[model samples]
Target: MEIRALVFDVFGTVVDWRSGVAREVRRQLPGVDAEAFADAWRGRYVPSMDRVRRGEQPWTSLDDLHRASLDELLAEFGVPGVPADARAELVLAWHRLTPWPDSVAGLTRLKERYVIASLSNGNVALLVDMAKHGGLPWDTVLSAELFGHYKPDPEVYDGAARLLGLPPERVLMVAAHTSDLAAARARGLRTAYVHRPAEHGPAATPPPGADPEADVSVASLTELATRLSA
Candidate 1:
């Protein structure tokens, strides 16, 4: 099927989320071990999501999960003296995630030819804030909050298709993560991989053999846009 709209995964896909988070954390705490704190905080992400998925806790957005994780990570890292108000300040960090350098320009190229939206696990509010902060230029934002499900869940993928008034095959899901593309591919959405190798850090490694499975793989959004625009 021909691809039309390009839907993106925000965190770690369009943006180097870990790097951005680490930068923010570092900026907020001068001369601190920012990278260590970034890794520590991100490492808590999945288990927290699992808690929500398993019904151990009520539905929570990514922002709330970040806050919960922050409290644990700060305590573990022995970061001293963050007031309650300061805690609220840190929780909003996700709102200002920085975009990958190629992101805005690449999305602009693709947008000239195709509709672009974010099909991410982030809630609409968070995605909106990030878009505004980063000048992401999305035609619309499609988050898991709309379907109350997260990525790798079929509903979120299908929900985006339904919301866009398109069939599964006509929409393309672009991301740096293979598992994300696998989920989209399983549901008939075309899959594209735009590499964000530094996503996990300098030593980050790509998942073995997953790139070939993508309809196309490129090093950056600009490259993806070039191919799609061709």
Candidate 2:
């Protein structure tokens, strides 16, 4: 099938969640290990969503999940001095994430040739806010909240293809995480890996190389644009 659309994993792929969250954490709680705090918050992301995915809990938005996790972490990190209003604002940090250096220009290039959209676990409102804040240029915003399932859940990937009126093979799932790509591939969607070495934090190690299971991989979105253009 000819590829027609590219759906991206927003958090670590298009946006730098670690630094973004850490920056907000530092602003809210000075004198803390912001990077480690960011990592710890993110570490709970999948597990938090898994509860909903497994039907152990009702469908919940990522925004709600982030708040729940944030509240718990605040207490754990002994930062209860943060006011409720401030904590609410801090939880919105996910909405204010910064895009990778090449993200905007690269997505613009790819958008010219493909229908680009977000395929993320973040809710639609969250994606919209990030796109506006980071100047992300997406044709549409698709989220697990829209389909009632998170990534690694077939429904999310399949739902994106369905919404675009394209077969699975006609849509490429782009992400920094190999596991996300693998899940998309398992559902017959093509996969592209974009390496994001510092997504976890400044000290995080880079992906060794292009993932063996990825149908295609590149160091940056700009490089992916070049490869697709060729």
Candidate 3:
């Protein structure tokens, strides 16, 4: 089936989360190792969401989860005395993430050809703020918060398709993570893997190559736009 809509993963796929978070950390906690702190905070993301997925907690917004993780990290990193206002501002770091170089231009091109939207684990408010901050021209935003389930769960993939009023196969799920794409594929969505080698920072190992199961794989969103003739 021809894809009629493209739903993108936000964090590391569209925005450079590690660098953005590190930048915020550096500003907020002068003596801290910003990069390590950023990595540690992000490292808690999946596990925190997993708690909700497993019914261990009721639906909690990504912002709340991020704040919770930040609180824990402050103590863990020996900076437990951070003022509440400062901590709240730090949690907003995710809302002000910087987009990758190709993100806005590539998405703009894709938007000209198909319905383009965000399908992310981040809450709608966070996604909206990020879009405004980065000048991302999404036709709309869809998020796990809407479905009360995170990526890798069928609900998020299926919910996006349902909300778009398209059959699963008529929507392409774009992401930097194979696990996310694979889950989307399992729910009958087409998949594109966009490589983000610097997502976890330069020292982290990048994806070795394209995902064998992805319908398309490319080095950037611009390449994805080209592959789809957007």
Candidate 4:
């Protein structure tokens, strides 16, 4: 099927989550190893969601999970003097992520050829705030919060296709993470991989330039747009 829609994984793909989180952490905790702190916080992400997926916890938004995880991370790091209001505001740092240099231009081009939307584990409100802050040009914001299921879950992928009124094959899932692309492919959506070596940090390794598994793979979203538009 010809692709009619492009659904993106926002964190680390469209936006620089690592740098953004690290920056916020440095601002909030002056003496902290900001990068390490950012990685540790992000490291808890999957486990927190896994609890929900495994039915150990009730359905919850990513924002709520972030807060829950943040409480633990702060305690572990032994950070000092953060009041309740400040803690709450700090958790909203996810809302202030900055977009990659090529993100807006690439998405704008792709938007002309396809219905562009975010298919992320992020809550709808979080995605909305990030979009506004980063100038992301999504046609719609689709989130796991909407379906009560997170990415790598069949429900989230199928739910996005359903909401767009398109068959799974007609919606391309674009992500920097291999597991996300793999999950979308399993749900019958075409897959495009974007390389984001710096997602974790300067030492983070990049994924292969080409993958037999991915229908398409590129160094950046700009390249993805160029190929898709060809």
Candidate 5:
């Protein structure tokens, strides 16, 4: 089936989360290794979401989860005495993430040909703020918060298609992570893997190139647009 809408995974796929979080961490906590701190915080993302996914906890917004992780990380990193306001500001770092170089222009081009929206684990408010901050031209924002389930869960993928009023196959799930794409595929959505080698940072091992199971794999969103004839 031809894809009519493209729903994106936001954090590592569209935005440079590591750099943005590190920048905020550097500013907020002068003495800490900002990059490492950023990595540590992101490292907790899946586990935190897994809690809610497993029904171990009720639905919690990504922002609240991030805050909870941040508090634990602060103490783990031996950076105590951070005021409540400061912690809150740090949690907002996810909202201020910068887009990758090809993100805006490529998404703009794709938007000209297809409906482009975000289908992310991040809550709707955070997605909106990041879009505004980065000048991302999404047609609409769809998030796990809306479905009360995170990526890798069928509800989020199925919910995106339902909300778009398109069949699962008519929507392409675009992401940097194969796990996300795989889950989308399981729910009958087409998959596109957009390589993001620098998502974790330069020193970290890169994600595998071109997922074998994806309908398409491209180096950047521009490439994806080209491949999709957008």
Candidate 6:
């Protein structure tokens, strides 16, 4: 089936979360290794989600998870002079993450051809902020917060299609993370993988046990845009 809508994964696919958060933290707390802090904080994400997935902890929104991780990292690093309100403000940094060089342009091209929306684990407010900050032209923002579920879960993919009034095959899940694409593929959606070689950190490797199979793989969103245009 022809793809009419493209559902993008925001974190590393569209927005450069690692660099974005690091830059913001660096702006606030100068002469510090903000990139290291961003890496450490993001490192906590999966295990934090694991606790909820295993039912060991109550379900929490990504916003809370971002805050919890931020607080832990702040205490661990002994970073000084932080106000209480800044904690909330700092947590919102994820919302305003910067996009890749090609993200806005490539997505703009894609948007001319298809409906574009975010299918991210980020909350709606977070997604909205990222869009505004990064100038992402999205038709809509969809998040796990709305569904009370996260990616790698079939509902997040299938449910999005249901809401968008598109069949699974008519929607394509485009992501930098292949695990995300795998889940979408499981739900009968077309999947495209865009490579963000620096998504983790300068030295970070791809996540362990990622799927080798994807319907499409491209060097960057620009390449994906070009291919889809054809």
lDDT of each residue in 37-136, candidate 4, tens digit only? 8899899999999999998999999889999998898899998677788678768999999999999999999999999999999999999999999999
Candidates 1 and 5: which is better by lDDT? Answer: 5
- RMSD from true fold, candidate 1: 1.7
Can you give the TM-score per candidate against the true fold? 0.94, 0.97, 0.99, 0.97, 0.99, 0.92
lDDT of 6 by residue, 103-125 (tens): 99888889999989999988898
Scanning candidate 3 in windows of ten residues, the lowest lDDT window is 200-209
Candidate number achieving the greatest lDDT relative to the actual structure: 5
Off by over 4 Å in 2: none
CA lDDT, every prediction?
A: 0.85, 0.91, 0.94, 0.90, 0.95, 0.85
RMSD of each: 1.7, 1.1, 0.7, 1.1, 0.6, 2.2
Error of model 1, residue 182, in angstroms:
0.6
lDDT of 5: 0.95
User: Clashes in model 4: which pairs?
Assistant: none
Cα deviation of 113 in candidate 5 (Å)?
0.9
- Tens digit of lDDT per residue, candidate 2, span 1-230? 78999999999899989889989988988988999899999999999998998899999999899999988998898886778887887789999999999999999999999999999999999999999999999999999988888889999999999999999999999999999998999999999998888776656676756888988989999999999992
Alpha carbon lDDT at 106, candidate 1:
94
lDDT of 6 at 88: 80
Candidate 1 segments whose C-alpha is farther than 4 A from its true place: 206-210
Count of backbone collisions within predicted model 1: 0
